[model samples]
Target: MMANPNYASLKELARAKRAQYGVTTEALNLIVVRKIYSDEGIRIDNWEFPRTIRAAYMSDDADPSVAINKTLPREPRLFSLVHELKHHYVDRPKIEQGQIKCGDYNENQTIEIGAEVFAAEFIYPETEFLERLQLLNIEPGQCSPEDVVRLKRECRACVSYQFLRKRLVRLGFAMPHAFDKIQFQKLEEQLYGPPIYKQKWFQRRRGRAQAK
Candidate 1:
């Protein structure tokens, strides 16, 4: 009768969706949330949403149509939708049950991050994205917001930071966290610069590396 607060519930929801729709989790994200929640008949209570940006919300009951806060960017919008779905199954009414306390969550809560990561990786496998980026000669150290956006546009990647971070992690690439990531900046700067020409350099070095 109560909703599950743990983000794991979302993962189960995601896994089930991927299996049913034949789409990767990332690709299935807010889109899936939008579809399933709507089919269930849940609608967002608009008055509860913030003013600046249209925040995504879900109605707890079977009235499944998702009320997307239109102003939120596509990435966060999708994440919020999933977060709201989590609320539908886990958060609401529990305040009375003492499962989750009121005002316990801020806009920047970490569980939202987890849900987004769940959605992103399912869409773009870290290994697959990195290998493809490398194959495109786009190094991780050489990535930026623009590069991220470009990659998402070109590869249809889910637009979330940790998703990109995971890909770089798998590729043994490090991102500068304290300040702006220079790698991405470099890529942005070089966008119109003379191209990088790597003529079979790896091919010549591959045999020795592979043999060792």
Candidate 2:
């Protein structure tokens, strides 16, 4: 596949690869990425990358590897890993030949964007995302930041708010950057309270006691 491949083509390729790997939508929703890497025999290295570089793919005939930024939150790390998988599949030859670099966003814009498209589709198909929005009664051009936060909480897909925002913009559910200024994370915490892990110790203890 050439650089700047169309979105449809990239989506098809991603779904095909998912099938080949026996990765179901449920698995993707849960972010079972490391298992995929292990199954593919791709080595994973969690290293500290510069802020601008989220991950890199290194292709080798015997052992392909991906280095991800260790500091990235769970969702972005999962996205980056899948992004490198695109390079491993379609851009390996170019990467190995030094014609393309996987992590450099400044160069190889076409391939980088293509990888992003592939990653997004692989992580959560557009059709499924649309269906989810419909199930939640979220309409095009009328989605609110709070609706997005609820979507994140209710949807099984492990995606960042930025991911949801971009999808909304692409699907005409919202204008570009409409949610950029909104701190979805903070809002989520405000609305839903902190995630279970961050809840107060007494709250956790109470929950555990209630569970028994």
Candidate 3:
């Protein structure tokens, strides 16, 4: 996979943003993004959208805006909002005149990669996140999913395990094969519990089905 071209700069930006919010520890809250939106004259709105689409951006040049799908869970909503904000702050030159829609920006493999990159780096600053990983004391190619989950909890960040695993490899703390998402997920369940997002979504679907 091609690396994010803007990785270094985005990491710095995320760190600065985190510091600006007085985020000494714990998760970098979505409210920090909202503060940027306020400063940049951007507006936020919630709208219903298809399951595949998580967020959208409309750049008026003077006052840009973002819309997050109302149905998304808390983690996805925060990440999606950051992704759209990336479009607003970094990729404004690339965005088309009026609007652009993002369907799970991470999976959109073309022009939107920069936004996804920004969100990942912003959510997990490289140096601080790596320091957290170091405390795990796990060797290369030996990391289990439970370790990543614990680190996520420690960081108080809502990022996915897959992202953490990739960061591990990216930073050379772990080898490429060390982070298997599927195996990690299984170990995660055994250690922690079933994924909350899937559990909630499944319950909601079942309720809707019963209602119908």
**Maximum-TM-score candidate:** 2
Query: Candidate 3 regions off by >4 Å?
Result: 1-5, 24-27, 96-111, 169-189, 193-212
In candidate 1, residue 2 scores what lDDT? 40
When sorted by lDDT, best at the front, the candidate numbers are: 2, 3, 1
Q: What Cα-based lDDT does every candidate model obtain?
A: 0.54, 0.84, 0.69
How large is the C-alpha RMSD of every model relative to the true structure? 13.3, 3.9, 6.0
lDDT of 1 at 118: 54
Q: Model 2 — TM-score against the truth? A: 0.87
| Clash count in backbone of candidate 1 | 22
Residue 11 lDDT in candidate 2: 92
Of models 2 and 3, which has the larger lDDT?
2
Over 4 Å off, model 2: 1-5, 29-31, 102-105, 202-212
Question: For residues 85-144, could you state the per-residue lDDT of candidate 1 as single tens digits?
Answer: 555544456533545443344454664555454555445545567666876667646654
